[model samples]
Target: METLYQQQARVFKALCDPKRLAILEQLRTGEKCACVLQQPLDLTQSGLSYHMKILCDSGLVESRQEGKWTHYRLSREGREAALDLLRQLTTPDAEAQSSGCACRRGRE
Candidate 1:
């Protein structure tokens, strides 16, 4: 059986696709209706829905019904987790900079 981390790795793999990454980038600006995603991506409604379903299942995106439209947005926790993972992956060498690190400088 796959460990919890392994399962999460699968979810992250789904996000690794460029199309899914583009979807997340679009959602980052604000909540968007399904139609909006379809338009920019030149994707069929069903295709777009499939991608959205994958994202929702992985807890990376959230959807809310508003009248006839369903608005989708990025989950805050998911976004922060992604950023943290990237930070951990590319952390600067401590010995490289005697004064300080670029990460600290950028944060400040």
Candidate 2:
């Protein structure tokens, strides 16, 4: 089974690319067809497909097919999950997180 950190790492790794992040911003407006995305992104059909596959794999996006075209959108559950992971990273845990550093111990 995958560890929680590993799973979260996948989500971060998927978003490391600028194009992938741009795609997410585009989806925030609403669901969009693959054809509509290509012009603004300056990506070829296959190029967009490559990036979309990574986004979908990370569970940050979803896709549907209609006739010959594909539509894509941000996933609500995915956004929540990513935020929760970020919260965990930022939230304080005194003993559990301490390394006994003088400065860090002073904060507590």
Candidate 3:
């Protein structure tokens, strides 16, 4: 099994690319077919597929097939989880602040 940090890192890695961010923004309005995404993003079929795999694997996006086309959309639960993770990681902990660092104690 992947460690907690490893799992978290996947989401970060998925989001690190400019193309991926753009793709997410495109998805914000609603679902889009893979073909529709290709032109605006200026990606080839393979390029879009590559990024979509990352987004889907990260749980930030979901996909379905309709005839020859693939449709993509933001995963509501996954997006919420990603938001919660961001808030948790960035928010300061009161107890940690009170404890102080060992390096500070050593200086005195």
- Cα displacement (angstroms), candidate 2, residue 104, comes to 14
Across residues 1-108, which tens digit of lDDT does each residue of candidate 3 receive? 889999887789889999999999999999999999999999999999999999998899999999999999999988988999999999998876855688988898
Tens-digit lDDT string for candidate 1 (1-108): 877677467457758778889999999899999999989888998889888888887778989999988899989887677677668657986777477677888888
Show model 1 residue runs off by greater than 4 Å. 84-108
Off by over 4 Å in 2: 98-108
Model 1: ten consecutive residues of lowest lDDT: 5-14
**Model 2, 1-108: lDDT tens per residue?**
998778788789778999988888889899999998888999999999999988887889999999999999999998888888889888998878656788977888
Cα shift from native, residue 73, model 1 (Å) = 0.6
- Candidate number of the best lDDT: 3
Which candidate comes out best when scored by TM-score? 3
Error of 2 at 7 (Å): 1.7
* Candidate 1 root-mean-square deviation in Å: 9.4
Predicted candidate 2: what Cα RMSD to the true structure? 4.0
RMSD of each: 9.4, 4.0, 1.6
Ranking by TM-score: 3, 2, 1
At residue 56, candidate 3 shows an lDDT of 95
